[model samples]
Target: MPIPDGPTTYRELAELLRGRIEGGEYPPGEKLPNIEELMETYELARQTVRAAINQLASEGLVRTVTRKGTYVQARLGRRRVRRNHVVTRSRAGMYIFPAAAYPDEPWQTHGTPHRSMEAAPEVVAEQFGVEVGSEVLRRRRVMSPEEEPPFQIVDTWLSPQAVADAPQIAEKSTGPGGYLERLEEAGHGPISWSEITRTRMPSAEEASLLQIPGVLPVMEMILVGRSGRTEDALEVTIRVIPGDRVELVADLVRDASAQWPLRTAEPKE
Candidate 1:
């Protein structure tokens, strides 16, 4: 193999490897070739190969074990389906629906809630467009899914008016229905919900709640729901989900090709 004349940036190498991995030539959980092998094959310096692998690892495309070699991390791809729902490409593309109607009881029957009637945090205040230190309805909950360990730890902050109107939220338990549903019932329909998904090693408290051993990475879903003119609304942060069990779905629609070229001007010449 011959090394290219110009400098070989890590981005270039990462793109090459990423293409191979996405193309299924290097399937998920498959160990990548050793550094020496990669250097020999690409005819690049060892440093270049290391840099490329580092880039991949940072992007969560690969994982490196102490004694073991580097292996591909399982990548999740989502397919849009319907409003607030998505078909995950993994798990054979299972459909995940949004939380339906408010619940009459707590999501988990075993635990208590932590509630505070105080000023919201800066982040929360900014999101809700309220002044810092303004009174807000704050509740923290640890919810278990079925027999599984506590699957999610949610910290929810709602506008004072939003909560006062729904008295059920005054308790430390989950509302009779999901919080979002309750918001809808209060006449604040969500114009959009933005989700930021990632995985990280859980904190000590999170690990204890989830009852998992070691530093197993857990999936985090942060959602900000906005109402009114698709520009603003209440924001909520929910974190920690068992990676193997939780699924996220989204649906998208586009005008069909038949609708293209709506009107063509007549030939003037």
Candidate 2:
């Protein structure tokens, strides 16, 4: 068999394949040619074809399955992330609730939390109202979406006392409602929480974990959850969300029943 001259560079091959996928030549969910087939058809080197497919994967345009083949990636739905749930906007904010970001249907992503003991960082200590370098429980969790690769990472720091009281918090999954529910059971029902948000390019390690393109920026949120009027926060949560499908919201309303924190203040001149 004779091979026709084709694009010589991986970039050129990637562009050609990208055009075909986007132009419906390959179609969504359609299996792309294997490495050998791609190399034979394009008359390109094996490395060149592999590199091209990898490029497409990085762009979220295709997915490769083990023992199977690479297929065109379907458009992914954006996840909802209520900024309010992440943190309260004002002092009057009472009660902390989990941000319901996804549909009521079974959640697609499950998180595996890794726990360890570490000295509290400056920021974390300030939020927890503890001395810097105080011991704390650090829980790092990475989440995977169903049938897709991992896309999010989270970190939660708690006062060592809190963890000691709720040993289940150290488990990878703390049953339904997760850590928050466990905390509540341990007598740390959060009355309120606050958050700060930042957006920036991912670190090399973060980019690798999330499998996001270098150009894509991620949202970093710092959330502090408190119970009653205690100056010591029960936990501080940090969420790293990649991609654009997220919303942050906070509601500041005074509850008539009870108020330990977020006191009403007089207007200043």
Candidate 3:
């Protein structure tokens, strides 16, 4: 195919290349045009072409080898997360609830979870309605699909009251229903969850662990668990996942005013 037009900016160059990759012009595992060729075709400078390539790499669309050219990365399967009810039961135990969404797709915690009492970060403190640097119990783990690279880094922060009431939460395994169940047993029953999501670039550690490029933005989901008894939030969970690999599904309910009917005026004569 002929080069249609030259891109003036690096972003434009990236978009053009992205179109080609998504359009199947450059199939997965196929090497993209070399920097020199792309520079010539787009009438762009080497720096601009490199920047474009870097952007694509950050978005997980392509991979660059040490000596070989950049190749298109395989399209990853997207995982859907139902926003309303994320947890479900399984024979093994209670998990964060992906089974109902994709029962056949196997997922598990990637490594040993690290738990400690640490100073709360600003965001965590805000969610817990505590002062920054206040002590909180933190549990960090990497959750991934079986036989696949890590995709999510989860950090569960618990309030002091929660820990005091449910001492079992500090153990390596929280029996059966997981932390939520434990909280319920401690009279913090009938827990309600609310979540807020935002996107930001990953940290150095996150990028390394997730095997994603630094430029890629990740979706950070902050979920708060509150007890029916009190207004205070009992637990906070921060889930970070690659933006490209996950889809969030939520059900929207309409109010009575939105009900469909013949409420419109008649046509003018």
Whose TM-score is higher: candidate 1's or candidate 3's? 3
Q: Residue-wise lDDT of candidate 2 within 152-244, one digit each (tens)?
A: 777789876667777887777676666666777777665467777788777776766665544457888788777653545778887777655
Show the lowest summed lDDT stretch of 10 residues, model 3: 94-103
Error of 3 at 39 (Å): 7.9
TM per candidate comes to 0.43, 0.54, 0.74
Every candidate's CA RMSD: 10.2, 9.7, 5.0
What local lDDT score does residue 133 receive in model 2, on the 0 to 100 scale? Answer: 92
Stretches off by above 4 angstroms in model 2 are 1-21, 24-74, 77-100, 108-112, 118-122, 129-135, 164-168, 171-190, 245-269
Candidate lDDT values, in order = 0.64, 0.71, 0.82
List model 1 lDDT by residue over 114-185, tens digit each: 788867766678777789888887777787534533656776777655676556556655444456556666
Cα error of candidate 1 at position 98, Å: 2.8
